[model samples]
Target: MNQVTGAPGTSRPGGRTARVREAVLRAAGDALVDKGIGGVDLAEVARRAEVGKTTVYRRWGTVPGLVADMLAEMAESSLPRARTGALDTDLAALAGLILKTLADARQGPLFRAIIAAAASDAQTAAALHRFYRVRIEEWAPCVNEAVARGDVPEGTDAAEVVRALSAPLYYRFLVSGDPLDAGVAERAAVAASAAARAGVYA
Candidate 1:
């Protein structure tokens, strides 16, 4: 029997099982970026990862299951959002990081693939939703800082304000087909800040 250990999809103690699982997830992400969700195949992914088809099927059980685990791994690897002493700067930094990730040639396509999958699949959609929720929680502190500085009203809807910072970026990424301009981050921060000041976020 093989040992089960390590991060969800990474090598642990350099074991074979860990390597196999990591390979599957990595292959899944690559397939997502290259072929989109409909094109991802467990057998093909196993072939790409140099693992046996039985191993891939035995581990993830199904395509949606594999995607869920892949999303879980990505969420785990993501860095925590910024939280500088100042809300404006913190938000700008957070948006900047988001913009960078969304603009990356590889990462951006992978994320777009995930978003496209979510629009059509319930399981995938739920996983993407959870990913964003975790991200929102990570960035909510910036809004709390604004409240502390009296720049925004007390008990402001931190999550909502945080969401605003990324909404335009998503708009550009998905629909607008516009460049994620450098000033967009600052614009988002300013708009969120103003909304918070007017008690709109509360």
Candidate 2:
């Protein structure tokens, strides 16, 4: 059996393979943030990652493939949903997380670039949708717990509630160009909680 050694700057399990993937994905993200999808090239990504071009080409095959893998990795590494035992508080926690991400200097640009890319690329759009689906599912349990506790209507759609909580923040981030703040995040959480309790999501 071939022994897998650790690659530099990577801490995940799977040793060298995981390290290479991390390096490549980080480089890809940086490229996307700096430029856009059209600007990202396999050669450039490999150079930035300090990996061989052939390795990158063989592993990812194409820009879309790499981007899809990047989304998968992001889904795997994303933070878990808040388990605060209350619908409002849990939604608030999720809102705060979304606010922080959308307001982040690097992450904000990265997401914008990805979203823009998704608009023009079918594969990227699919991958982006998948990423959101994973995120929504991860957070849906909070609303389900609320239902279990009788905080909301018994038939409330947990996933839709989670999506509702996030839609406003995303709108501000990607569409309105409005300033994102703690207050805005709090309001989104409150609105979602109220709507869920009112059976809007039922």
Candidate 3:
């Protein structure tokens, strides 16, 4: 199989299988957060999950495989985009969601570890890229709606505008080490909205 997701044990988690998968994924996440990529072992994950060693090995097979599945699950479970009619409100809502996730205690550290691991692993990097792509696609419609409302330019790039909205918040979380707060998130939304209206994203 190309990856663990293609392995026999992996289907849509429904019953006992679902519980096991959830346990294993949670264990994997904890291990990754606590020890980084280098420290994630199938045996350790199985032990932490209270599952059989063979189960972990059979399902995930490798550290990268387990991490890939974790990323897939995370994307699948992420919140949907804002439904507020106005573009400003929609952007602000999206920014608020980003701020909430990054400011979260467990999530903040977990994302940092995953991002750091992605820098050194091809499979993990691909998975991380896919995660962001899913998020971008989810929120891009806000900009498209703004175009229809004549709020932003007709040709403004929706995906870019959404990305721009989240960029500053990410910069604080991942670089510059600036404190992220409600004021920071609000500024990002306002700036991105103004730039979109100005056709800077066109």
Model 1 clashing residue pairs (backbone): none
lDDT of 3 by residue, 73-181 (tens): 7777778888889999999999999999899988888889999999999988877887788788889998999899898988899999999999999999999999999
Residue 107 of model 3 has an lDDT of 84
Count backbone clashes in candidate 3: 0
Error of 3 at 3 (Å): 16
lDDT of 1 at 45: 94
Task: Return model 3's CA RMSD, one decimal.
Answer: 3.2
lDDT of each: 0.79, 0.85, 0.87
Please identify model 1 stretches exceeding 4 Å from their true place.
Answer: 1-16
Ranking by lDDT: 3, 2, 1
Candidate 2 off by > 4 Å: 1-13
Find the 10 residues in a row with the least total lDDT in model 1.
1-10
Candidate 2: tens digits of C-alpha lDDT, residues 119-185: 9998888888878887888889899998999999999999999889899999989889898899999
The TM-score-based order of candidates, best leading, equals 3, 2, 1
Evaluate residue 200 in candidate 1 and report its C-alpha lDDT on the 0 to 100 scale.
95
